[model samples]
Target: MTAETDLIKLYSQRILALAADMPLAERLEAPMASVKKRAPLCGSTVTVDLDVEDGRISRFGQDVKACALGQASAALMGQNILGRTQAEVEAARDALKAMLKDGGPPPGAPFAGYDVLEPARDYKNRHASIMLALEATSQAMAEAQQADCA
Candidate 1:
C-alpha cells in the first residue's frame, strides 16, 4: 500500500478502536442539560446530555449519528469528560481549538490521554466531524452552568 493509504488506514483504525468499546446507549438522570450540533456538509449530528453537580460533571451521555470520525469523536469525549469540571472542560476545548488553529500541543491534563486527536489537526474537513461532540457537550455544559447561576 502507498504511504497515503497507510496513513488513512492507521487513522481509521485508531478511530474505530476508540469507538469499539463504547456502550450503544447511555442513561442519564434528570436535571440534565442538552445541546446539539450538526455538520451540514457531512450530514453529521451529535446531541449531548450532561448532568452537573457541585461544579463538576456527574454524568454525560450522547446520541450521535455520523461518519466514523464523528462517532469516534463522540465516544472519546464521552469517555474522557465524565467527571470533569466545567472549567476543565472549557480549558480542554480552548486547548483543542488552539491546537487546531495555531498548531501546538494542548495546554493541560484535560487532554492528557487523548493525543490521538492531534492527527485530526491536519485532517482539515474531518475536523468538523471530530469536533461535533466536543462542541455539543461544551455548549450543554455552558447552558447548564448558566441555569445553575440564574
Candidate 2:
C-alpha cells in the first residue's frame, strides 16, 4: 500500500536497527535526576534517568515507549548522552526541532546520530516523539544540577 511504502521509506532499515538496540535501555540503579516526557499527540513517552558529574552526564538510562521514530531518536540520544552537559543536550534538542520544523541542519556532533532522522521532517506530527528523549535528558540534567546547587 502507498501508506506502508511511505512509512517504510521514513522508517528505514537504519532507523529500525537503532530502535531495536537502544543504548542505555535499562534504568540506572540510582539516578541523581529523572524526567519523563510524553508526546501528547501520539501518546509516546520516554522516561530518562541520569547522574551528572563535573557538569556532564556521568550515567544515563531510559524507558522508551514509542514508535520506531521515537525509539530510534532515543537510541541515538542514549548512545551519546553520557558525558554531555545539559546545555549540549538542549542545543541538540533545539537543533532537532529546527531541523524538523524549519528545514534547518542536523544537530551538531556527539548528537550527530540524529541526522539519521532527516527523512522525518515531512512528518510534523512525529516531531515531539522524536525530540522526547533529548527533552527529558535536558530536563533531568538541569534538575540534577539544580539539586547540586541546592
Per-residue lDDT of model 1, residues 17-133, tens digit only: 876755423645574698879987788888778888888888787888777767776776676786788777777777767777678775467556456666667667776777787
Worst 10 residues of 2 by lDDT: 1-10
lDDT of 2 at 104: 94
Worst 10 residues of 1 by lDDT: 22-31
C-alpha displacement of 59 in model 2, angstroms?
0.9
* Residue pairs in candidate 1 whose N, alpha carbon or C atoms collide under 3 angstroms: none
TM-score of each: 0.82, 0.95
Residue 118, model 2: Cα distance from true site in angstroms: 1.2
Candidate 2: misplaced stretches above 4 Å? 1-4
Q: What is the Cα-based TM-score of model 2?
A: 0.95
- lDDT string, candidate 2, 1-150, tens digits: 488887888989999999999999998887999899999999999999999999999989899999999999999988888899878998999999999999999998988877789989989899999999999998999999999899
